[model samples]
Target chain A: MKTNNGSSRAYSITSILILIILAILFLFPLYWILTGALKTPAAINSAVPQWWPQEFTLRNFEVLFSKRSAPLFEIGSLTGPIIPGAIRWLINTVFMAVLAMLLTCITASLAGYALAKKRFAGRVILFSLIVAAMALPKQVILIPLIKEMSALGLYDNLWAVILPTVGWPFGVFLMKQFAESIPGEMLEAARIDGAGELRTFITVVYPMIKPGVGALAIFTFISSWNDYFLQLIMLTSSSNLTISLGIATMQAENSTDYGLIMAGAALAAVPIIIVFLIFQKYFTKGITMGAVKG
Target chain B: MDKTLSPKLRRQENISGYLFLLPSLVFFLAFVVYPMVMCIWTSFTDANMNSNTADHFIFLDNYIELWKDPVFLKALVNTLIIVFVSVPIVCIFSLWVASVIHKMKEGPLSFFRIVFYLPVVTGSVAVTVVWKWMYNNYYGIFNYVLKSTGVIDKNINWLGDSKFALWCIIIILLTTSVGQPIVLYVSALSNVDHSLVEASQVDGATNTQVFWRICWPQIMPTTLYILVITTINSFQCFALIQLLTSGGPNYATETVMYYIYYTAFKLYRFGYGNAMGVILAIFIAILSAVQFRLAKEK
Candidate 1:
């Protein structure tokens, strides 16, 4: 018994040490991006890699901002003052993510509730189609989606990205998992009081599913923000480009300008990373809930 | 759970249900279902970016050409290699990480989870570009660190060489991929039935035996989930290749996803690209079905 206990303790200590090392390895890239963004060009291009910036400078960011310019906001004939293109890209990304989140939450919660609680016709078939679609690669449908967007005169628009993201079935499936737990008795009691369907959903059901909505909201936001492939395909104009796409195009133009590119990367990554850190609990719950019930 | 409803009650339920579903159905049908159907139909026609005339039906022509195209074949093989290698590694790695940290105090557990997840939230372009710097021919920390540690005497152009390029991509892919699985595994592990574990331990089962016999079976569903998601994620690896290598070094890192992008967007061969997309979808569907079958048998 003594020998067994000793061996188990030894095993745990070694494993914990390995986990710490692995955690650092995982974090190194973000660290590199942040530090590389602040490093001087000489340090960036030196033969000896600097683990930390020896001379911190904002020259990279200045150069990035100076590369191009776009209007801050556009409202038909009225446009906001021109700003650095990187800032414009950042604003475009935030708008895209927020709109996608809102749309997905509203649509998915309603559909998910019906699938879980309402005895609707074609429920099984609709739910099955959703599951099947979720399993297939979303990229497979992009070609047709592009042509369809163009036909609707939405091609090269942020909506082309936002609408497809909203249409993804994962959010609906996740809400259904959450909706399944709503007490049937509560819903029945609401109905007994002669409450209409919308009234009951708004007052009772919405409160119950708020946490699930929170999770889905954050999930949709992060995904739409980092959905580089869709953003790359859908938006082509320099002003319409998301920050990720902007940085990618910049990388293509100046492959070896590590400092400037890293600055752009930092700008693109930091906002989403901050959001992820703040709402990580919901994000984690959203991921596990989607998988566990499926 | 079903209870018999009166005729009026059934009608009321149907109306309410369809009302609730209407908003989502509109978007789903317009964006998802329509695009999917059109994707299949377009794969059989001679569609291109510059063609204004109606696309003529050329059934099976694109599919036949895809099978004969060496670039497509190479991309398919590379994609398979990525999926097969990353899925098992990610599963085992996350399982180990989760089992270790699930026993830790709350503060440390969340810290580890957040640390691992940072890469994923960092955005692919940022992550890929940073990695591009690390794999650079000169001034890359990887070469500097390895050389200082006496691991290698000369600088190795990691991404410029075909032999090492795919492996480097896979390594970066694994880092981004494992975060969610670890979260899932940790939750799954904690939810395992402790009663059974105690019973086995009371009967003098060894640690390994308890894990293999009791804990493993209970978490098989989570394992299967991780496997499928990781496989899909690996197969869709595009931004990394596009940013870092652009499927170069002699197409060593070409993947079906990237090739589809190249064909449709770059070459404007919409029909051919849609054909590849169809094949890719079929491949994923078959693999997912096989996984489900294997899991069910177990």
Candidate 2:
């Protein structure tokens, strides 16, 4: 028994040591990006790489901003002020992500509540369809969607990106997972009190499922912001590019500009990372909750 | 309550339910279902970007040609390799990490969780570009570290060489892939019934035995989920390939997802791309079903 305890203690220590090493491995790339972004060109391009930036400079970021310019946004004949293309791309990314999150939350909660509580004719079928749709490789639909969006005259619009993201049933599936946990007794009580559908949902269901919505909101925002393929295929014009697409295009133009690319990478990654950090709790819940009985 | 509801009450329920569903259904149907239907339909016809030539019904030709096409074959094999390799690695790696870290206190646990998950939240483009630079033939950190440590004698072209390119992409895929599974497994492990574990311990079961007997079965659903998602995500690893390799160095890293994008957008063979899409969907469905069945039997 003493030997067993001794071996087990050794085993745990070894495991923890290995875990820290692996954590550093996983973290090195982000550390590389941040430091690489600040490192001067000579430090960036040296034979022996700088583990940390020796010569810190904002020249990379300055060059990135100076690379191009675009009107901030367009509204029919009226256009917003001109800005650095990188900043415009960030703005576009925010618009796309926020709008997608908002629409997804609103639509998903309503549908998810109905699926959980309503004994409608097609509830089972619709719920199944939503789950099944969540499985389909989202990129597979990009081709047909391009044709469809073009037909609707929204091929280059941010709504083109936002609408499809909202259309994907992941948010609804996740929300339904949350909605199922709302006790039937609560819904029954609300109905018994002569609360109408909208009123009960607004007053009761919304409050109860707020955590789930919070999870979905952050999740949606991050995914939409980083949805590079959809943005690449759908948004062709430079002015319409999201930050991810913008960086991708920028890299294609100047492939070996490590410092410039890292600057763009920092621009693209940092804000979303900040968002993820703030909503870490809700986001974790969203991921794990959706996998329950999945 | 549902069974006892009167016809009038059921009717009201249906009305209210459908009304609630209407907004979501509109977006789902228009954006998802319609495109899906169009994709399947287009796969049967000879569609392209030529405005003068209307697409003709040419069923099975695209699917048949896909089997004969060498690049498609290579792509299919590469995608399967990615899915098969990365799925298990992700599952095992994450489950192991979760087991160790889930025992930690809140501060350390959250730190590990966030650290593992940062790659994913870093945005794929950011992740891809940085990886591209690090894998640069001349100035990459990998070569620098290896050479300094007497591992390799010279700088190796990580993405430019056919032999190393696929594995390079897979390594990046592993970093981004483990995040969600780790999150899921952590949640699953911590939520395992503690009383049962303590009882098993009192009966003198070892930690491994306790984990296998008490925790594993309870966490099987999460395992199945991780498997399916990792498979899907691995199968759809396009951004890294696009940004880093573009399936070059003689198509060594050509994946079906990237090929589909190439076929439809780059090559303008919409029908062929859609055909490949259909085949991919079928593979995912069958694999997911097989996983579900296996998990059930266990």
Model 1 clash count equals 0
- On the 0 to 100 scale, the lDDT of residue A19 in model 2 is 91
Regions more than 4 Å wrong, model 1 = B1-3
What is candidate 1's CA lDDT for residue B189?
92
True-vs-predicted CA distance for residue A195, candidate 1, Å? 1.0
**Deviation from native of the Cα of residue B153 in model 1, angstroms:** 2.2
Check candidate 1 and list the clashing pairs.
Answer: none
Cα error, residue A124 of model 2, in Å, equals: 0.8
Angstrom error of the Cα, residue B85, model 2: value is 1.2
C-alpha TM-scores of all predictions? 0.99, 0.98
In model 1 chain A, the worst 10-residue window by lDDT is: A285-294
Candidate 2 ranges with C-alpha deviation above 4 Å: none
Give the DockQ-based CAPRI class for model 1: high
lDDT of 2 by residue, A1-294 (tens): 688799999998999999999999988999999999999999988888988787899999999999989998898988988899999999999999999999999999999898888899988888888888988888899999988888899988898999999988988888888888888888889989999889999998999999999999999999999898999988988899999999999999998889999999999999999999999999999988888763
lDDT of 1 by residue, A7-122 (tens): 99999999999999998888889989999999999999998988878899999999999998999988788999999999999999999999999999999999999999999788
